[model samples]
Target: MTVLSSSSSRFPYAKGSDGTRRLGYGADYNPEQWPREVWEEDVRLMREAGVNIVSLAIFSWARLQPTAETWEFGWLDDVMDLLHAGGIGVDLATATASPPPWLTAAHPEILPVTASGATVWPGARQHWRPTSPVFRDHALRLVRKLASRYADHPALVAWHVNNELGCHNVYDYSDDAARAFRVWLRRRYEHLDALNHAWATAFWSQRYSDWEQILPPRLAASHPNPTQQLDFKRFSSDALKNHLRAERDILRELTPHTPVTTNFMVMGGTKGMDYADWADEVDFVANDHYVVHGPRDEGARDRDELSFSANLTGALARRRPWFLMEHSTSAVNWQPVNLPKKFGELARDSLLHVAHGADAVCFFQWRQSAAGAEKYHSAMVPHAGADSDVFRSVVELGRTLEALAPLAGSEREPARVAVLFDWDSWWAAEHDSHPTARLDYHTEALAWYAALLRLGVRADVVPAHGTELDGYDLVIAPVLHMVPQTLAKRLTRYVETGGHLVTTYFSGIVDEHDHVWLGGHPGALRELLGIRIEEFGPLADEDTVGVDAGPAGELTGDLWSDRVDVTAPDVEVLARYRTGTYAARPAVTRRAAGRGTAAYVSTRLGVDGLAALLPELLAPAGVTSELPECARGAVEPVVRRDADHRYLFLVNRTDTPVDVPGVEGEVLAGPAVRADGRLSLPPRAVAVLRGPNR
Candidate 1:
């Protein structure tokens, strides 16, 4: 057997024993969906496109195991052998993404129930409850078998544990979930009194005397207890994580050398499963993202969404290059209305992921499915075959990736700005009983991040809790609703020692258990911010408040407004409410503590409002933009550097051409370039420039 050794690249790519570094291309290979004759053609096209890697057996559980005891590996063995002979490596899945019909039919109790008490039928993918012990036993059995069979396979380079775990059924409110929730709560709160107190059950006469009385937050009378719902979200995420760990453990014991990973849906539709906490369990992080459509104005919003998803995924991987496991070659079938990409969008989007630290780029499937729910989804081999525009773009992207292979292990330029994005806070802040139902955690954070991106400042979307803040000069936390005491202390020290902070409304209001910190609102950060919120004045959906910033002129904000009372004389009011019952009160304030500064924004400032405010907020931290001021909002510049060279990725998100000045470099990719200090970027074009590290 030819043993494939791993690469020393900072990014995780499958390596071979010959010490060759190969870029991972191609897509999910579902040979089971096609006949044996088509498999050879698939391999032929893959080689023609410069493809080197393909994920196999992702949803083949039913075919791999036809019965309770009977197992079949004949087809998979043939496929693997064919791929190896074709010079392609395999990211072999354990085929545990979905259970066989027999298993689900035999143990219907393992199926998941929704919050409304409706059973999610097993016809769809990921239909089983995460905490089902019966399901785990069967899943582990299949995983052990696959691991032992493929441990020594020459084509096997990595193990894909499952296909997007918890994508469809993240939360299960069944009786089994109720019992598991009780156990998870016991481990969390230790005693019943602590759990009751933390949940504040005394208000509703819902205090539990025994652990058995506790249940998953199901349909409740009014709203379920906030902390109970919070813990349940944690529990659900941990449950899926435990399943991943189970499969990971089996694979490690059997094939210690091969790396293991699972695809994560880190896009806008995802919630519940915290990928940050799940990052360590996988050898490398893999993510699936699709361009969100339905907006009337699509170009800029889609670019921002893709950039945000890619940057967040890279940060979750600790700035290490991760994998773009799934993205559409054209229109995705799952949106409200699927819109196909324009002429240059395929290469633009793929290279955009590479710019944001993705080492590998793969799609959903190699060929367009003739049947199934995703039949209309685009693939490398589109319905038009190899002569089509999509296929030509796929082949072009393969060649581009080959040219960019020298950048495999490179990292994104160190970001001086960091945005705090906490999944726990995302769940807690968006709970039913919040001050405003319109306050979305990710939307708020994305507003701030988008503003920074417009300013041409690269920012890392980092976790709120347990992330080190020493390296960042500016930290922005928008609507950080669940700031624990430890995180509060870390932020305070970060500001006191010279880091600048800008946090928005509803922040620092609770501990880890969703218990409010007494005294005034903005609880733990009151001293650092030098302001106390006496009351929260949530706005109606249509209502807007005017903020007067003196020289910066008036700005409009909505969704939430806090009645701020300045507590310290040193705190300067940057902006005030121009009209309202709280007119002339502070809407934005900044305080200097020790050597650093902390600023508090008391309302939801839309993108334009933040764009107006970021200049003053960033000036104190000595952070400035790399692009010309004229090109600030028109073009987005992202820099990634290695030991030898710096690569500048300039993306023009506008419809008209934009000229970026003072950027002199050798053109590495994109359209025509001249040796002058300025480059004109076409509409929706992406330019990759290589220059000296200075």
Candidate 2:
């Protein structure tokens, strides 16, 4: 049995106060909603769960600033005192959840104007204009005031700036936004001619003689061009960033020691704000992961997606532990069919988040509400109290976490492989007018990611630009459409020096300006990949192409199909389409570089194709993908390790019983692959298998 740590003791989280590994729950406790007696019960429950951290002041803007200038802290004081007394660290929010009703009445500009030129009202939260200077001025004041008040508080561990920036309808299309957009475009294009050239305005007789002609591209009239639509997405992302930076800068000034992070939605192409760029401003990254396994348990819907998102955040965070900012303890109110968490699914889901580099696991709310939008949402204490199943699961998981602090701080070093994930390219590629509208960048990356995950190979998603690729034995660039010249040279060096580099279709088609690279398909990669594309064709929705992808027989897929010319003599054809006009031709080919090789996947195939491709690719580099049979009905398993410790996480997304291997006299649990060879897992449960004693 794990002994619980006292709340008054120093935080047991190992990655320093702000480095990475930290454990806590996202506290949405509001004593203002309940009586003072209820607040005491909330603390006891949190202590039971071993939740050392809590996110406070979120959605309390209306409560704190009930009137124009009157801010109330009497209720907040009691709540904070109780949490600290219970030994819970606080990630204080600025309480700007929704601008106070009085602020909106006094200053209508604080409200956002939607794309349709309609000004949104104050009832709903997150409707404030991000780019409005007035909003910034007021938001900064609130943050400064809050920081000054809580800067010295020992309970304050971090700062969560504003609840989900840009989560509502796109705002601020008034004159101010138009003016800012014009300024942003000028800085980007430098001159009218360059802007016209990049936007290809000459072809449509849409030449902008003056910068003012660029009226933010879609307020009065929606974007006509695909590239412009993409740029608008990028611009919107920047607008969101500008809002966040305003608060982040102020908070850093008040408390430079504490880390600050805004919750980022995973598997999303946040238009203008690149997560990579955002990382520089944040001390660490945190994302809200809500996994929903649908009713009747046909299949696991949200579990794998959440884990993938966690991994993506971890990759961007550089293996630093991330916080699970928000996850559902039970059924979410917003979903069409609100299904409660299956038995053990909540704990399994939480473990899954931790397995994929989460230091803290926090649910959206701590107390179930009788009113409000999220009232139906589950919490630590349900509307029915501790008798509920959700409360039991929270208590059980909490007790387990208190004993796992040493494991929490440990890092997850991926196996010798890296996946190039570029936010800029994702933004750019979606906006491009490719023949196929179903070009899913997230799905494509997941194809490779899922393959790596199943193999139990640790993969890190690094920016395509300037990230070190020296140590990775194999680097896979999936649909890398925008290639930085510097990255091209690096890839060339990697391939030339006997390092393996793999790129898929649409790999290197454009430069940073979104300009097509002249003279063939995979622009800069042609010389290294030893292939040039003469003509490319898009497959119809019902269409399918077959390729003999090595051991995996006849891989098939729709959407992307390619034809290429093998220019390098040393290149070997690995697989080719067995059907079509280009029948019996090479679909997957590899070129022998000095001591290494570069493989080109000319088409996008399904999961089976990836399973086949990775083995052939990783084998030459001496990398192995483990295929352990999951206990029946269990979701797929994932494993990550530190230098001498291995953490095996198995998720039981299915309703039926599943078996996982158990650990005995071992450092951790799950299957053990010794110097010899062996593997097995007990039942639906997850195991953290530790390595041999050094």
Candidate with the greatest lDDT versus the true structure:
1
Error of 1 at 11 (Å): 4.9
What tens digits encode model 2's per-residue C-alpha lDDT throughout 149-172?
A: 888887877888887666674446
TM-score (C-alpha, index-matched) for candidate 1: 0.96
- lDDT per residue, candidate 1, 1-694, as tens digits? 0001223323447333566555678799999999899999999999999988899999999999999989889999999999999989898998888888999899998899999899988787988999999999999999999999989999988889888988888999999899888888889889889988889899878988888888888997789888889999999999999999999999999998888899998888588799888887888888989888746753366777788889888777766678898998999998888899987788778888888888889998899999999999999998889999999999988987877766666778768898988898898888897778888887788888888877877787777765778889999998888888788888999999999999999999988988888999899898889999988999998899999976667989899899999999989899999977678999999999988999999988887788788888898899988789889878777778778889888888777888887877778777657567788888778888888887
Model number with the top TM-score = 1
Candidate 1 residue spans exceeding 4 A from truth: 1-20, 297-299
TM-score of each: 0.96, 0.89
Error of 2 at 44 (Å): 2.4
